[model samples]
Target: MWISRLSRFLDSVKQTLFILGTGLVIFLALRNSIVWHMQEFWGASGDFWQRRWEELYLLFNQDDFLLSVFGTYIFTTAVFWLCNLFFILLDLTGKPEFLLKYKIQADKNTPLRPADFMKAAKVALYNQTVVGLPMSVMIFCVMKWRGCSCSPADMPTFPWSVVEVTIFTLVEEIGFYYTHRMFHHPRIYRFIHKKHHEWTAPIGLVAIYAHPVEHALSNLLPVALGPILLGSHLATAWMFWALALFSTTVAHCGYHLPLLPSPEAHDYHHLKFNQNFGVLGVLDRLHGTDAQFRASLAYQRHFLLMSSMPVTQQVPEPPKKKSVSE
Candidate 1:
């Protein structure tokens, strides 16, 4: 018991470090570029700088923020959206029957009908383009104002760049866990988070299928938090967004692929409704929510058995044969 508790504690600590590390990388990356401009225009040192505030306000107003917001969000979202859509289609097509083993809720997944797939795809994509896009724009605006770069030159190259992206990803996941939990509040869930839940058996693109407010707050905000806090490079932030989007997409893909974060965790969240709220399940475990979630899963198994729904239950192994001598 103590060993398990310690493991969870370490995971939380590692995640905290990732957040701080990401912020540090951003601050360092932006210091010469964005921050330098900030200091120069605002005056590095001045009388409690009330004038600097006025100057900064004018700079904010004059800069082409709308272009920055829309352009960055659209481009980054498109790149990963395509990547996600590709994998989703791959899973649906299942060129090799062996790949089916990766499916999570295997029995519950109805035979893929062209009409049904299209309908689900349509709704998911619609939500992303409409609701998700605006949220991304807003999040980009916040990160830009706070000092994250929009210039490619600002990004550190190659292996080193991975560090920045890696840390920010961890930070984003942690931020998402808490923000998502709040979205499930009784008052908020029906009005906002419920839209995403409409598809109990979610598809890849459902990652972004959500109410506008929920997308902005629960989805984009957590993602945006890392770059804003870190003051990350444009490329670093871009890569982070790409990876985070892919992760969410796969988590909704309804697959239980080995050596990958499968859909099981979030699938349970969607189906069961009240448990497994965290992206990585670290926060859920630390908070003891995972125990409740596991219990619910057990209940589901029991219910399926009691209802004699063999089709929905996993196939049991055949009884062992005994030797005649025994």
Candidate 2:
């Protein structure tokens, strides 16, 4: 049994490695050209916008306090709303036929009521302003004490920025995996983590609809620890935070659009509650928490969708086992 599990685990790791390699290749090939074009565009921008941009950048760098208090709040709020509103609209529209094909939990997630949206929005708002703002201040203090650089001149180059974010992702995966699994302990689940699991078929807005303690430990700390440990540039830290928020929202979006990361694994986590407790699948595989997921029909359906065609839940049959003689 252990041997079979190890084989499956190895196959998943190979797939993850292949995806990582392909992403790095593409990022390396395009980043220089992209940066060059961006610089050219900035250079060509008229004096009016250029001055405004400079002023904004200066203001952002003027003090870590302002950035921590206002910048984090504003940036996270904007990204959260932008990402979730799009999906909220889709859900409000009964998930039009065009998108219905990709809805992972279509059967389970019936149309949400107005009150449901209100409850989610209200809790999300409280978390963002009431809970998040103070936490941001604390994180800023920690980062500053740890000697993280906020200087624009000291910002990492694009490749190094990528490297930093990658490390941040790995750190977050480890932190989140263990903290999340711990939350599932019966002694603690109801008091803290249960609120997050309220949306069994999660929507985008519900991504951060967690208990404040759970939000702080599982959602915020994991993402922040990497930059703090590395003493990364403030800019790099913010970039990673944005990506983390967006990706977490996408993971809970319930729709598996083509060209995006598959939501199947997380959607399954929401459904079953006991499997897939990590941001990335790395820790889950090592801990064997994903055993049931790997054996389930959803595992067969878990795929990188490349076509606009509608997806179905049809699980293909396993191949016949060969006899020793054959």
Candidate No. with top lDDT? 2
Backbone clash numbers for all candidates listed? 3, 0
Could you tell me how far off, in angstroms, the CA of residue 243 lies in candidate 2 after the best superposition?
1.3
Off by over 4 Å in 1: 1-67, 87-95, 157-160, 294-326
Q: Residue 63: error of model 2 in Å? A: 1.6
Residues 143-198, candidate 1, lDDT per residue (tens digit)? 76787665433435444556666666667667887878888889878988888898
Per residue, candidate 2 scores C-alpha lDDT tens digits across 136-200 of: 99998999899886655565665677788888988898899999999999999999999999999
| lDDT per model vs. reference | 0.65, 0.82
Candidates in order: C-alpha RMSD to true structure? 11.6, 5.3
Q: Which ten residues in a row have the lowest lDDT in candidate 1?
A: 302-311
lDDT for position 43 in model 1: 53
**How does each model score on TM-score?**
0.67, 0.85
Scored by TM-score, the top model is 2
